[model samples]
Every structure is written in C-alpha cells, then in structure tokens.
Target: MKEYFNNIYLALSTIFIGMSVTFKHLFVPAVTIQYPSVKPQLPTRERNRLYVNMDDCIGCLQCARACPVNCIEIETVKKIPDEDLGLTSNGKK
Candidate 1:
C-alpha cells in the first residue's frame, strides 16, 4: 500500500513539473508576427502560376499537349493567314 502511494506521488510530481515548465515558457516573448498588420515583402516578377497569351498563340496547342497530366484544356480555332495577331513577351509569333 505504501509503495503504491509513493508511485502515485512521484507520477503527480512529474506531471506538475511538466506543466510548470509549459506555464513558465508561456510568459516568454513570442516571435510571432501580427499578420494583416504587417505585409510580407515579395520579390519582383515571382510567379506562382503561368499565364498564357492567347493572341500570341497560333492555336499550336503545344502548351496544352506538353503538360504531363494534360491538365491544360485548349480549344483551337482556325485563323486566316492574313489575320494580325499580337506578339509574345519573348517576341515569338
């Protein structure tokens, strides 16, 4: 009976010790930033998505066909050879 009581006391003491350590750290300074109050700086021209110019495309469907999973869906329509189309950012027709 004494040994069982000693083991319970030791377990309770250890649990309180763990809880005390957690409570002590809760008073320490936090490194967390105030979101919305502070905006994170982003590098220039950093893109998370690819944007395609349809005017620059000659209905090649190259980008759509090139995708590994075929995630890009493209609808191709025939255009007259004499029609004018804008240039790409890389100056490609």
Candidate 2:
C-alpha cells in the first residue's frame, strides 16, 4: 500500500540522514586534548580563579548550592547557644 511505501521511504531517509552526519564527522579530525600533558591556555582577560578563603567565607552555602559541578562542600559545626564566636572580618556575626 501507499502507507507501507511511505514508512519505508521515511526509514531510508532517516537512515541516510543519520549516516550522512556520521560520515561527515568520520572524515573530520579529532579535537580531543591530552589534558594531563597539554593544558589549554585561557584568555588573557579571564581571571581563571578557583580558590575560596575559608576565613573570609560568611558560612553562606550560596557558592556550594550554585556550583554546576557540586564540587564545593561546606561542613559547619553547631555553635553552643551561649558561645560568642565573635564577628567575622566583614562584621558578620
């Protein structure tokens, strides 16, 4: 029937389209980098910073919660109710 031919045509067209993409990529050179040996240079304008000073941290988990990779871990100890830990350098109690 016409429907059977249409299904066959659709399957062949999709297969050709998918194989075309695979063939195009097969001829292209690989862009994989040897990360341990060759480090990629960053832009001059980029700070490329990845450090956080614990002393300056306000115990806010915003950085940890917002991290895309979930790499930042914050462990806070419960302070005694009557203990006075004093204010931070930024005057945060």
Q: Which candidate number maximizes lDDT?
A: 2
Per-model TM-score, in order, reads 0.36, 0.38
Off by over 4 Å in 1: 34-93
Q: What number of clashing residue pairs does each candidate have, in the order they appear?
A: 0, 0
Tell me the tens digit of each residue's lDDT in model 1 across 1-93.
999999999999999999999999999997876877976667987655555776576677778876767788988777689996667768766
- Candidate 2 structure quality by residue, lDDT tens digits, 27-84: 8987988987998888888754356767677678877876768898998788799998
Overlapping backbone residue pairs in candidate 2 total 0
Report lDDT (Cα) of residue 60, candidate 2.
Answer: 80
The residue ranges of model 2 lying beyond 4 angstroms of the native Cα positions read 36-93
